[model samples]
Target: MRSSLLRVGVVAGASALVLATMPASLVSASPVTDPPAVDCQSVLAAPTLDAAFDAAAEAADVPSDLLRAVSYMQSRWEGHDGRVSNDGGYGMFNLKSTTTAVPDGAGKGSTDRSPRRTASQLERAAELTGIPASTVRSDDRANVCAAAALTASYAPDLNASTQPQRWTAAIARFGSADTFERQVLTTLREGRARTTSGGETVTLDGDPTVDVAPPSASDPETDCPPDLGCEWIPAGYEKLVPSDPDSTGNYGNHDKADRTGPGGPKLKYIVIHDTETAYDPTIGLVTDPGYLAWNYTIRSSDGHIANHLDPKDVGWHAGNWYVNAHSIGIEHEGWAGSAGWFTEAMYEQSAKLVRHLAHEHDIPLDRAHIIGHDQVPGVTSGATRNVHWDPGPYWDWEHYFDLVQAPIGQSAKNTSSVKAGDVVEVRGGYADNVNTITGCQQASPGSGDCVPGQGTNFVLAYQSPSLEAPLANDPGWKPNGAAGTTYASDISARIQSGHKLVVAEVRDEWLGVWWAGSLVWVHNPATRPVVLRTTAKTVTTTSTTAAPIFGRAYPEPEAYAPYEIPVQSIAPLEYTLGAGQTYAVSDDDVVTDYYYAQSFDGSIPDDRTDVKGELRYYQLWYAHKQVFVKADDVTLLDPGKRAVVPTRLPKITGEAKVGSALTVSNGRWSREVTDFRYTWLVGGRPVAGATGYTFTPRPADAGERVVAVVSVDDPALHPMLAPSLPTAKIQR
Candidate 1:
């Protein structure tokens, strides 16, 4: 944690007297009051959390009652330990500070704004207690002790008082927020009972009539931006159910889900979106039960906000339910093509709201965690080609990130310099960016204005540094190797701001990146900053030819259902990275699975469920689009050295029957690679152009048996090959 105010004063005798009279929620070393089920001696002698708090309070000369009350208000007795809260707080006391470690959670690839500092309360606690930050993060007792010490240090003027009301101001001072004191006093007076993470019972008795005189602030509601017009318009779910017995539920807006459990899918992302409609209509659509629901909606006119759902529940706004389940979707009033629809007031207010929510949820303040709706991935391989692109090219990501206090260019020293294997980030200035688009139309039919607008979240990639050069090729969009276009919907060639990609080649003022399995160039201006550089690990192939790229990351074959027809082939892409080309790997070992929920209507069985697979793939920074490759395909290596080689081999899949397609799977291994290649062998002889994920037995092989030769490679290692055992003889 950064340096904080060390404002401890000389401890007066009144402090000790006040501390001696207060009743602690946990068992203490002293026998001043009736202890709970646990005895004071046993608690202090053992390494229980209660003893740590008691000792810390004693050492700091703080009242244990006050310490317990403050902690309860912050985390409700649940210590997240190493895992941080949405607001960046950690452990039982919700300590927050900054360090350079990347946040641990889902979508690791999307959060490549690495080499940035992060602060947590846990670090602050470590600083005060003189305990190692690692120990404080892992040990519950140490965490509690540190929190107690910090709280004690904050209230040097507090004296021993039996009544809780007297310590209200000091308690408030401990949290450093306007609402902290009232909330703590409220919990202290009313009392609280909770089962700690350790399964121990702790309780604080309530005092209904206790008067808590706290120093009030002018703006008491601290969670919201004071300048915005925010309202609470509830959206009812009961009306969504059908009246007729045979009819399915009409609810399509949100899910009445259970609380996210400890091992349950974690809440990792906060999606930003645009309504593409008027503010009132968007609100009406959100509240209409038949339409989808997002957590909050910000109007463009006055920056007015309407919160429709609880953050804990799932919203149906993002096309992907897996993301919807693990995210808080916030919609802004605007059209994708029109710059006038996104107002400065709305942007400021949204940033404030986002900052507040990110803090409250302990979400990391980075582009990966704070993503636009356009960034959300499709559930299946086929769906990737079509997803919402609203809050599009005009969202002003650079300015928004600055408002969130995690600007991209501030983290690294040589942010402007680029080199081969360096991770290049598109940091195109939102306001100053002047790329021309051929087509600009209003998102809504009646929204008006088809004229091209001025705003940007992307930079056009070209074949060369000059503007006359053709746009980069997108294999997924144009497989024949056609040049990319300036079409508004043509996201294939443009690099959106905040996305990190590996540099494949670099010239004087132009740098090439691996995009959609081909080298794409970003024109670097000498005067104005268009790209930033950072360090990242990448996966490359040792093959002499281009390597394949995939759309989805799926688990190995044995892990998936045998009868399940491959929804969309996880085959190697036709467009491949040139041999020796290195690209950033988003995540080397990404789980392969599909979220297969189609509707909220109960009449349709298995409507809201996930079809999971055990397969794994490596997510790569190959293109503006999210792409993946099988874990067995390439080697995982750092910038300077090669990683250890895998000892595992590949296995053949699918029935060996004639006319049936067979595939190969990478067997279990410690580490994962990408760009898997395959070859079909007929009686140990190679077949031409049979290099896809699947292969069919040819008619000419009347008696010859079939087998599959699977090859995997990366820049660090030579290609690793495994041939499946020969199948039963082919029957003519």
Candidate 2:
């Protein structure tokens, strides 16, 4: 008999706060000049002020003419400082009023406060200019300066090369709703005013020099050398032919100007981009002449690749002149900073396109050269502070690299074999359960459980110059930083020093390494390994004892009851036997229903029955036999020891209603049963449990319930009373 009882306990909630802070690094400045206009009114009237706009633009390190055009577009040079719009925008630059507040003397506040009037605008500005709202609003000069700074954030090289087109994009970020003509005119007017006013002009390497080239006049044809691995094929060009095509290959009313330079160099890099729009919308926009154009548009569904621009001429993508001149841009249909997994088809097609392009161009498929918009270095040291982060963290670089079959080898020089005491560099990405990650989750540890399908949100662990080792922990973690409320440990696991590992290991999984004096891990996917090749060799061997035959013995004698012959055997093993296999054993008798068996590992003979028992409880009539076997040198033919089936206890048949008690007897055992687990089973599953031994008929419990219960003599010593093979009948 055994005792039966249930216990429950109450649970409590706990919380903790940890203080952490890191010094902010200074951002680099741009080399372009500022516009000449001082006030909104003056900027609206100016025209043909390229020189004046150039000077101001130079100060901002943005193209002088482009700045003038954008100023015309936004506020039309008609903005007033005291005036306010419905959206709470103010100032000549229409700076949003919603501003981010600095950490007050009081600890953490209930909400973040900023000068920017609208949350969205402030966020957009912050993203573009890389300037904190707290800094932007502190001074009027900074407000307009930051606005210009944000404009310069676009690819500088692109701006320099495609001044009109790239600058239009940079301004569009600030005034997307405005008409193109209005935007361009406003920027030009503002550019003229700023230049005349002698506003600051940006200089490169501290040198005040300007190289102004005339607008382009002719559209150049694409030319690929025979040896470059690219073939001129017209198969997909038909799909791109616009329905209402004009000379510029555009159908709409937007002005098209050809700025293709004279013979220089063929485009080499194929830059990938996302439209930051829905699929259908992106496709329409890319194909529309009125909107900006790229060389190709990749569909998300079938990964259907479409070509719209010639690879030879520059496409208005990447927002940088330098990049635009040498790169063929491919726009992927998607939204920026949105949560959505790219389809397998899209990845496959994109990989194919990239591989073909890589073969065509002499560019190496490596991170330093083949990078995301975020990785593009600033045009000058000063411009590094302001750059856009497109193709954000969600992109899976590792899987993409694998598709190209780039050589990813464990660096032979890596200290992977280093001992525990030795140091190594372990690196990898920090993705939750499903393996996506981002820069960092600036939250409390454990407060933010990793969301499934979302990429990691943390930075990579780099070796610290002072320490000659990777940081003890990922620097990306700080509760109050851009990531917000996420703890580093909660977001990423640790990798140690002296650990040798490849770069690909860090992107989609939890990666770490033993480095310096400890193991450290970081969430960075951009870092991947270089490509390589390998080969294999062969060796010889031998065998023994005809693979010793296997068998199974059951009804293990040790579990047998008194007077019970528990010997049963199964012949020559049919299946390949290995470790960890298990099987059940039962008696041959169907009516008697009493048997016992034990599970064993390794090989066992079909004739052998291992048994042990006390004389009072059980005994075997066979002559005493002893077998000697080494602890580890034995194999079990039987997958496992057999399972012992208990003998059926006698049933006390009767009928009772609702709460009546019942009793049954077996040999010398007699016990009263109350609330007995009464169930009936027709096939194999359970029916309903009834309180009485005999249940009344009910529609729901009509099916047989296989009732089972364990009886107990003492409250503490509870022994199970095996029920008779489930009796079937109505509850009545």
Candidate 3:
């Protein structure tokens, strides 16, 4: 959000205001000389935008660094052709004249106003340089030249000793915003650099005479919570060489491009992730020029934040490129199934950061926009079944939303039972909601290593309302009566919280939801239900008995050209939604297509290879998973009010450090507990007489894993035993 008050170059008529302000002593007495007549075609031939800008500046007698800084200020050096900003700006220069005129005001109705003229910036540039507006809009070289010409018009006294501050007003005019001028000056004085995805190196050294001004009106301070020691460690974008000599691999995990151009992708979501690794290691990974990156990472220990990539750039973290293109990724430091819960400090800071981003970007404050890595859609049919599920079930979506000022339970008071045509939210409370998920250490190679501290924010689906019944069937994974396991590899048997479900059948405590084309039941008793009743539009099959489901929402046959592969556009999955089943439809109208580009190939005009289909699909909230259905075969129902699941998880604390005592804290719970018992284990074997509040490890425990198990007993609730995540090999 750069302020627009520092405009010093923009003026009425064909010339800029700075031209008249030039000191006579600073002006060259010799006749003004133009470098050379290089057309847009020649400029486009350069290897990188840096080269093009350098050449343009040389020809136009403008400082190459100034031109580069101006372009960076305008579009981050992304070449956006023919796309218009919200304020009618276009191209890399973001010239306002090419598109509709948008008022330049800091806020809605203020006395201050920018100079409004009869001509647009594009028209003025064309008028001053005799270059066609179409050429300027269509060619990268032409755009650079136009930008260079503008900079040349504001040329001030020049020498090796010239201070960058002297050109601040001119730079501000180039960006048409004072805030932008500060950004340019800072970049110039501090040095601007980045390695393009195409493997080109670009850098501009800070001017020796230029010093960045102190924080002021144009360069405001970042408003962050005072307690958190926030730091801005820029991610390395330097071109890297492969460690293996024979490999041609390189890394600088982001693309420099605008997302809203005609061929450019539109951003729509913000994804949350958990770094399976710890805080320091995670920071190291992100800073490695050769590794992937996320927009932000929140330290679990102290709720510290490190912002690496700019929100405008695309980072390579999400497995799906479309999601990567459309979303900002935030990584939290914690294990998905560890006994130690996410700290409150981290949650507060994360909520504040997300709230600011959502408000600034106009992102919807709902599950649909603010999502986990598990919810990102697969790019193709084959990719859907294996999409990652991270920032896993343990993440407390309920608490997170509340901190963001959008609690999921805000509508829970208005509804009660899970009914047909109504939406239900799964509410497997984190921490204390002791859920039984089989297949942990049992799946390991030799001796399995598993612990009770393994927690998830999901509830297993059952075939009947009673817990005695077997789990529901998954047509894709366990079609032959295989039970769903808690192993990370198995996603069939559970329904995570925060997901919306369409109620198909409600029998007392049991509620059936349409899951992966089948009716799956989950225990939702009136006394301790895992789900909350909420008003939502439900979609049921229109066919006599069932409707086929699909891994993707591709277009109809007629949408594709005859030369292309036909079946690739519309392949139905092996599963189907039964006629009697009802499921919540998050969005009934969605285009069926894929943003097929896996990575940026460094095309100048952004050649995004896309696969668009003509068919329409409805997004269904199936149990804990998200799937697609044919919009044609489903009938949509409208319901009025809604309810949400409650959150309740007991907190556990203490590190599993070797030779050190371990402790567990019972978290805030909805039910009252009468007593607590503790048991310590060494290498998964229960220790004799080891039951205590704390136990110091001995030499015998060396090289063996250690853990603490706490059992809580309550009068009205079932007895629950929660284990701590095992420690590394115990030290002597």
Best-performing candidate as measured by TM-score: 1
All candidates: TM-score: 0.52, 0.29, 0.51
- What is candidate 3's lDDT per residue for 1-732, written digit by digit as tens? 000111233233412222334333322243323211222333445677778877776655557787776665554454434443322345666665643333453222346566444466676555444456666665566688777665554443332234556666556554423335555676677676765323345678777566655433211122234333346766766556545232223437676545545543455667988887667888899898778888888865335678887666678898865567767899987654432345444676689778877877667787767888877655544465566666765577876887799876565742346564457777666544656544432332221233454446777887656788777666566656566665754667677766777665567777766676555678776667777766567776564446766645655656555423333445555466664456677666554554433223443221343456667788777634455787778777666533211122344343433333333323323333334455677777768887754566443455777666655433222212111111122222
- State the lDDT of candidate 1 residue by residue for 42-88, as single tens digits: 22234655555565565555556666777676555656445433233
- The local distance difference test score of each candidate is 0.57, 0.34, 0.58
- lDDT (C-alpha) at residue 83 in model 2: 35
Off by over 4 Å in 2: 1-262, 410-453, 457-459, 462-732
All candidates in order of lDDT, best leading: 3, 1, 2
Local accuracy of candidate 2 as per-residue lDDT tens digits, 350-406:
776677667776555644235455433233322333444445444555556665665
Task: Assess the local accuracy of residue 72 in candidate 3 as a C-alpha lDDT between 0 and 100.
Answer: 55
Model 3 TM-score is 0.51
lDDT of 2: 0.34
